[model samples]
Target chain A: MLSEKHLPAFYALGALLLIILPWILTAADSSYLISTATRLVIFAIGAVSLDLLIGYTGLVSFGHAAFFGVGAYVVGILAFHNFEETTFLGFDGTLTGLIVLPLAILISALFALIIGALALRTKGVYFIMITLSFGQMLFFLFVSLEAYGGDDGMMMFEGRNILPAIDLNDRITFYYFCLAIFTAFFLFCHRLVRSKFGRVLAAIRQNEDRMTSIGIRPYSAKLLIFVIAGAGAGLAGALMANHTEFVSPGLTHWTKSGDLMIVVILGGIGTLIGPVMGAFVFLLLEEFLPIIFHELGMDLLKEHWRVVFGPILILIVLFAKTGLYGLIFKKEG
Target chain B: MTQLFFEQLLNGLQLGMFLFLVSAGLTLVFGFMNIINLAHGSLFMIGAYAVAVLTNLTGSFFLGLLLSFPVVAAFALVIELLIIRPLYHRDHLDQVLATFGLILFFNEGVSIVFGRTPLFLNVPEALSGAVQITDTFSYPLYRIAIITVGLMVAAILWFIIVKTRTGMRIRAGTTNPEMIRALGVNIQALNTTIFVVGALFAGLAGGLSGPLTSVEVGMGENLLILSFVCIVIGGIGSIRGALLGALTVGLVDTLGRAFLPDLLGQFLDPATANGIGAALSSMSVYLLMIIVLIFKPTGLFPVARAA
Candidate 1:
């Protein structure tokens, strides 16, 4: 009854459950669960976007978090300007989601274009290191911007951006809003990956030489996918900043990229729904690991769970070739 | 202005030496083993921590430095055998992720063991005083010593890599591992040796840097990125490239940080000048790297592969 062939039905059932999760939690008298679910959906957006480049295009970008950070900063900077009643670079910083969300996506895409253009010149480990350096450069740039609260980061005094007919202030409304965007984006990505462009990306990943011989320029193709991924990450960042009402330089840190990479890997790279599963598992572990350690009376272990997490990661790389998604799907097919 | 220029130049050279110590090992590993060890920074951290704790116990900085090499080497040996060896054949992403996992592990593990408080290591009394470089400019003796030690190690490494029998095998291994294996060299043992040696160099950089900077958890990470920049700019897998790249990075960073704000103050408002200068100077090395990549995608000194 639960074979690999029925995976899509299972995914549909899971989506239905995710859709009604907040209601179920509210009925169970758990308001906090809704917030966690919101975070899961937001991070899943990022992880899934990253999977586009890493899983499909074979571009291991260690700076994907930079786009995410830039997106959040666009929201944060605008809000900061609005709160201070100051014009930012000759424009009134608006808090309309309609304006800000698109702005976030465009700015992030532009950054990805520049960085990806340069970083794509190098291959393999060099690409990883260069992307990391670019990310760090952005991180430091934010840290030095004293106007935007500098190293301490900025807070959103104004609530969520206004949307006509949508009261985002309500926890359930915000959660569902995020879910709606995430679902749409996920569908877009699923369809995109199955398209001709996705086929070109996969071909480049498998054999760039062959693709080049076949008249496909890998650079433009990879760059296109990279921008798409950045835009997706930017959307996630905008939503995240609204949900938390805060933005920090930590969002762009290399470790944040690593976390996203972990989600992709844990979910099973190249799988459409795998990143969502990965984000859920990662967030759940982050939430419950401390409690699990506390129950065992290992408070120090609870605090330093990464000590255990590191070896588990190594073991996963060495042993689990397909990851958790593969385990659930029973086969990669 | 001339005195200040010379002083900043010396500072740059000093920073370059510390970078060279780290980059050399990283380049060597990449060249021969083709493994990108992200936990190389953790090895640097271990070196500093070992020296800090040992120096505190023994009351001798020299003894602590001497002890750190073996300790770090042993740790690296274990890691190489158990962890890094398996990763050699895997794709770069898996290696990056696994090693990244190691970084998280080591950072937290050190934090757990050493506590969250930063550890301090003082320059030895013999090296603490300033040395007169000129009539108007005096340089710290400890920094000069770091430069000297780095050069000596560089020379020694050159000798080993160029002239020694082991060096020939390493060179061969880098160009063609299968051929070297067919020639009766123990490629496994050679890899193990190279890893240990690289770890020792990283450890040395950390141990030496302890007195100059705060010896704390995660300190090696920033330095690790800088060293990667060095290798990338100089050309991956080439010792000459690492040295050149390290010096270039060191000079640019030191001189930029010291002078950029003042330089910008003349053109812009002081507040904006300082803020923008700080950001730009921090970004200067990476900008250099990007420019180099654009002009020479392989790097400034790419190692030649055997046909």
Candidate 2:
């Protein structure tokens, strides 16, 4: 008899089968659709970072975008003098923008350290609101830096500083780069879940107090994961800036944060690949609604795509409460 | 400096009053229900929309307010019954997500219903002028009226909670729901009333803010977050805490924004001062919140006895 504890890998195989549907999406002449899909994957990376904290680690953070925004803004500020500013780090201010990923990751990890150090002192809703406040502080900081575009975010004139002489700005190259990053992040996340550290995180999630009673200080582990998650989000943000060639304060808005949370919850949080799947569906819907509304000639709905999204969110919460993955595949205890 | 100080004081008070009105209902519902209502802000948004549209249609702001509160409260009651009540025993995580979804739906619904352009809620001619507060600076008469009305609401709310039989049960319900239920009190009825009251307060606040702000989509979100901060500071379930939190937040935010830049300019370069000042100004209230949490995690007046 099937038990409540375990799900088969066939579900994941099915997921992999669908993720490549984007090849068909490239039918349009321009890489607009592909890039959009790429952008969604980037956000999925960030969402997955959050899911690690929120879904599996049992911590709800409303400020993951702080890491993402910081990552984007770092690139924007560094590349200020150069429109397609590549390598100042290694190649005399002429490196490809992709080469700057380490810098973004490091900075975001540092931020998570300060944030997590203070924030870990609180728990429950306090944790959520405190993280949110930190994000707001960073948001205001970015908004105040007029030189870096202030409320109006700076547009990237060039692609990332790629290493090894790869064509960094090429759309296809960046698309594949994003795909590789997601794959690596997915695999990395999968391994982490099955590792000892992952088990500690899961144990903490199931019950932190009990974990504490057993002599495992959940705080250190949680903070460690927080840094890792921040690094993941920062990498995603870097890729996003590279992919879109634009970065804005909208990157740190609370609503954007909410969307990430929704994606995490929607994708079946604990499932390794769920966040990416959630992001794909989310962005697809985000794209599809406007086109459908336009085709249907509901001129009013052309701009109200979010209205459609909101009810869909409600329905997901109400009916498909386990999220798409959970609805399809039950988790093992 | 005195004049500047006085100006900041008034600004803080005005901001505090607005927050107090909104947070009153939020804290109560959160306290009694243990449910985090992210959609409460949507209810606030809807209330503002209703008040704005009705005021425009009827050409009577007071009438609009009169009609708006009941309708908003009713909507809240219906939501509680249809959507919220059943989820009471469900996981808190589920409630948070659902309410979050509600916020999205409502924001989009408003966008669809009302054109994206910001709606202007015209101040009534009756309250358009200003009352002189000092030499060189006279405050708007309508804002003064708003403060006065807010104060009156606060007084009545205090009386209702402190004096009435219903208030007694509500207070009991907050402290020990099991006890209240065991004593034959219908918590369903109480929860509904609390929800209605919360809606009414939010609606009134929305109606109040309509004239001061551009009434439009997502208007309630900022206010909602601020009010949550207020409730947190005030002690989530304590009405007294909400009031104090509102005042504290109001003062810090308004005063910080009004003068922090100039204060910094005295010591730093004009541009650097402005940039850093703006950041600090926006962060003052949140800074205050962090300090509060550090000292008093449960807040100034936590209602629930145990965790």
Candidate 3:
């Protein structure tokens, strides 16, 4: 089995690659790769936050995209108002990331608190369904916001959020900006999982009744982690809105939540770095699978790549029980 | 206004029937097999596609609908043996992931074969006309037929589940699968049978409702989520719960959309009212599910000894 001792090396290697990737892609005249790289990093952030719930706490929340969407919409809606020179709920729009990012995190945390409070009352499948419903509720809410473009979504006209001393419009700069945020979150989550609170979460996942018997109420601990995860996802969402330069209700869909889960599982559920690796692999497959199909004279299959991808996902779940991180790093189970 | 209200009520009932058909299968699978089959929607989607193609081929919507049951059953049988059987012992997370993959496969596969454009069917000639309920209002015969079929299926399902030998074993399996297996019953075959039956109902709903809506890729997904909400509201394993939950969700959703905007317009400006109403109505069923779950976490009609 993989030893935890080697994880620091893996983390260092992964971070080094990310740091140097822009130069490598630019050197190869594949600077477009930076765009995809940025997305993968942003999604890695979302996937890692999800891992906190699914892996550490054993809460398989299916509505996680709600926070992610809320964060993106916070940026998108603010940018929309800035473009129109109007106020949203009496506040003038601002493109400043310093303000928008924190606001996004705060609002998403609030959403998580409300949803978690109601949803935590139910256990197992009921919790999953309630969270899914809440996510769908948020999705539909955004879809009905005609002022912000509704189903079609809204775009940022003024470009990416303005950060002090950061030129976000430059691809490499934005890529580095995203990379820096991802690194900070990655380290924070790493420390968090080793903390006393994190051990308690792991204990709760194993035996909630036992945890309760020991005088620790699982609800507050679980709810706290849920809020933290939501805040993290919201930060990712804010970055995503800037990266894509647009926001839509689709971001909050249950399918998006599913995608984040898939990424986490693809890497290795419990490992924070696993989701980041999973994001790298997933985005690569999405980018190149269609091209690979077309090269093999399966032009019809190019657009229908999901037909192939779906079975791959099934096979992974069925057989690759430990995911990619475990596949590469673990010597044995 | 009364006529419009009546028509919307029927619409709600019609939608409720669809929800029951889908949720009946979902709840049974979840209850008995201890699996959450996200691809149950794919089976429903296939049923609609089957009806569309067969109806066009045979020139009779009824014949098409009848044939779709067997087609969907066969599909369900294959899926159960190859995929679901292996997952029966797995955790909910694994089952969810696998079935979600199946959804993507089936959706993309359908689109590849049928093309992205949605297929449509005309209502069967026999039920094409409307039945007059009053001087000012007439309800579509096809919709009424859907409701009748839904109720009939519910009755038949109730009989099979409550009165028959098979029903006895199913109830036993849900509570104590190991004991049932030890009791000399072929649990594998029993599981397959239940899965096929569930798939049949979903297919029947798809075929019957195909003409009322466009037969398109991913159509079953929206209905699947709604039915999931119904299952959550009604109680996961109880057929009676599924019925109550389905009807409540269908009614709330339809009525909310139909009258919420106008009702709001009475007090607010039309534009804002319409926007808020549309948003709220879309969320109404979910809100209802949340409220119900908050009050009765087990659902309104939870089955005792559910897996």
Candidate 4:
């Protein structure tokens, strides 16, 4: 039986795996593997941040990737300005990770604050649709910015941002950077979900009326969590932009947000570590499903793999309500 | 200037009617079942595809249109039975997830079958020409026909909902499902009927609009979001709300796109004006929704039960 006592050990093992992933890949002479692992870590950051809202707070925001896109655009826009040697608004665009990442988080948090304040006014499916509208709004806004390449997206041709005391240009160093940030974020979320605020949010999710009866206003709690989640998503976006060296309006599309939601559900809703596992599994399936089909001599199936993926997702939703993580760590009486 | 404004108004009306056709079904399904059918758009796509394929095969647009309603409804009935029925008892998130999965299935399935190239459906021969509306203005007859058909459907729907026995049962079911179930109404059959009816409406909208737009995979996705905005603004589950919401969205979207850039160009550079205008026009409906939500969280015409 899985017990609360086992959590720390589980986390420790996870940390160990993350720390050694790059080394293992390097030793295996698999640069591609290292890059794929980096992508997983970055997406895990996004999935975990999204879980903070959808899983913990019960806010099924269909626009979480808006913040993710905001983060990436911040990095991309700043880099674009730096490349042109121009000042945007007032500040000279800097390629420093320290400056850009914090800016990304703050900007995304502010966007979340504005969006969440209005979205939180409604409950249930209304909230979902409102968030999706906001996401689509941001997507169109980005696409309209012709200076940033519009639909074509922007590329950081100069490569990764500079961090003091470390070379981000090195693939291995970049991998560690992402891992470290992801670790910090995971720990923060772990503590947040256990904190007083998180409990209040969880209570609100269960029954907002009861919380209100207890003299607890659920609105602020929900808003705070939404902003925090957005900030985390923003940080992930910044890392993603750095990793891919590209940012596009597609990053904020409603479909990307749906993908994030799928990751949260596929792992385990409201479980802090579940999103990380979910991201890993989701990306692995995306990577391997086509290869597996090809190996089976079904090349046509490989091209239309989503036909298979969709049914699997439906089955998971129907049969594994608690998700893959819950199945693995079954609760005991 | 007046002629141009009127022309845009007519375009808005045509678009609004199309939106109503889609939103009406969505509102009905959501009202009673309390399920968010993301794959509702898939039904719309199916309708358009059905019309396109059938029309091309038969070389008769009218016959294709006649055949698509039943074909799409049958498809929806199967989907409701095999997929959507189990989800009726699930939470909103699960419904959203499952329906979202269905969307992927339908989109990819269509792509695999149709090979991704958009299918074209021509305007019917009789409805192809433009009619003079004013000394300076001529509008396409097909668009006017759409508006007339939309109003007719709306009237029929209003009559069915307000003046029929089944409508009473549906309204009762929405307000109190358990009470209606205890009253010996087969809630399952009612729900399935409503789902199929919603699918029929979506497919009809798709078939009718196919000639106006390209019939292609994923074409319904964007329209689905817009229809959602209409439902949210008009108040979910309220037919009156859906009609009002659809018109408001259609007008705002059409007029905003037609004139906003020109308005902005008077003050700003053309490039900046164009950029900002496009962004604002695209966001206008959502902006209206946000404003409406802030003032009326339940929407402009929320059903009594929803409140």
TM-score (C-alpha) between model 4 and the true structure: 0.98
Which stretches of candidate 4 lie above 4 Å from their native place? Answer: A1-4, A27-29
* Model 3 root mean square deviation, Cα atoms: 1.2
Chain B TM-score list for all models: 0.98, 0.96, 0.97, 0.97
Sorting all predicted structures by TM-score, with the top scorer first, yields 3, 1, 4, 2
Report the C-alpha displacement of residue A78, candidate 2, in angstroms. Answer: 1.3
Better of 3 and 4 by lDDT: 3
Write down the DockQ of candidate 1: 0.78
Tell me the tens digit of each residue's lDDT in model 2 across B1-307.
Answer: 7877876787788889888988998888877887778888888888899999899888999999888977897789878987788677766666777888788778878877787898898788899988888777778888888878778878988898899998888788888888889999989988988888888888888888899998988888888889888988888878888889998999999989988889999999998888888989998888888878778877788776544
Best-to-worst order by lDDT is 3, 1, 4, 2
Q: Per-residue error at B82 for model 1, in Å?
A: 1.1
Clashing pairs in 4: none
Question: TM-scores of all models?
Answer: 0.98, 0.94, 0.98, 0.98
Poorly placed runs, candidate 2 (over 4 Å): A1-23, A26-31, A83-99, B134-137
- Candidate 3 lDDT over B36-84, as tens digits, reads 9998888889999999999999999888988888899999998898888
Determine which window of 10 residues in candidate 3 chain A has minimal summed lDDT: A324-333
Candidate 1, fnat value?
A: 0.73
Off by over 4 Å in 3: A1-3, A331-333
Q: Deviation in angstroms for B158 in model 4?
A: 0.7
Model 1 docking grade: medium
